[model samples]
Target: MISNAAKAQPRGASRPKGLETAARVRKAALKRFAASGYAAVSMREIAADVGVRPGALYNHFPTKQDILKDLMLSHMADLLQAWDSADFPEKMDPLERFVRFHIRYHLEKTDEVFISYMELRNLEPDNFDLVEAERRRYEAILTGILQDGAARGRYAVTEPKVATRAIIAMLTGIPNWYREGGRLAKHDIEDIYLELARKAVAPGATPPLTGDRMT
Candidate 1:
């Protein structure tokens, strides 16, 4: 069986000395992608930033695209599975459960979501399709939750699917503009997003209908 800390224990995959190097490479990739985006960043530059030779970097990831894909798929899979297996608060209302989700997801997987959203066009078609499908699956979870909340009358969006998409867009936008050391604490940002989401789907939002009501 694989060790609890790792998903699989491949030969030569684990060593204390190399663990630090691998971590550096991963951090460098995330930082580089965050600052410069996927298409403009290169494997050689990433390796240099991590203080490894270009060829040595392949020891951790076979290709630049491979690196991006792994980074994205890990969180995408987690978010997808998380919602499916999630247990919401019994004490809180359904809308509050939705609020809690916005905060938790952004806090845990902000970097991955940032990359997935910004770098889609950089991926080759096949790879992009794989990532996009996972994303769509993740989005479906929110839409499903919204649909359920609407049915229960705890939430009141005219179109559950569109509301779902809007809520996600609004929540995800937090990380884009948020800075770790910025004026607002990270938790505060999460709270703001949660409140915004609650308002978006709050019962009896009255305005002239616009856009696809259901998406």
Candidate 2:
């Protein structure tokens, strides 16, 4: 007979062996892959970091490339899920909403962002296709937003797909040099970038002041 205390001890108290091992493997792999390029990391090193035998690692991930594929796929899938779950203001402009969301999301997952872009060449052809498909799906979200805004005459974008590519490239580059205690706070950076993105497509944006002219 089981007691209430036993049932209420919480799930982590008795986590399944398989799940625990897999999670440790993922953690070790992520750290290794990020610190060193994927090509430089070996299954034995990951297994050693997890305090498991190399052979045991193969039981979970048949090959190191499999682990790399999983990591890449998971990163993109998580980004898509986060975007899907984001709460946007009911009255917020779509472009503004997207700008804030992209900045905040990418900033929070800097390591994942770094690895995803830097390690693409390491992925095999089929794996690359799978990851790229998810990436394009995510990109489509912004493209759709720009297209709708243009159709409503809120934005001056002539090519929604081109605008999407440019905007995403600009936003995703933030994690490269941004630091927590930098001169600008994350919100400040977001505001600046948001305005930049808005003006990039804004209909009838004010012309820049000339050398001798002031607005």
Q: Model 1 over residues 47-161: C-alpha lDDT tens digits?
A: 9998878999888888998888877787787776776676886787655665567667776777777787888778888888898898777677677778888888877767776
Against the true structure, whose TM-score is highest? 2
Task: Please write out the lDDT profile of model 2 over residues 91-110, one tens digit for every residue.
Answer: 99888888999999999888
Query: What TM-score does candidate 1 get on C-alpha atoms?
Result: 0.74
lDDT of each: 0.77, 0.89
198: Cα error in model 2, Å: 0.9
Q: Please estimate how well model 1 matches the true structure, expressed as its whole-model Cα lDDT.
A: 0.77
Backbone clashes in candidate 2 total: 0
Q: Which ten residues in a row have the lowest lDDT in candidate 1?
A: 5-14
Clashes of 1: 0
- Summing lDDT over every window of 10 consecutive residues in candidate 2, give the lowest-scoring window: 206-215
Model 1 clash pairs?
Answer: none
Estimate TM-scores for all models.
0.74, 0.86
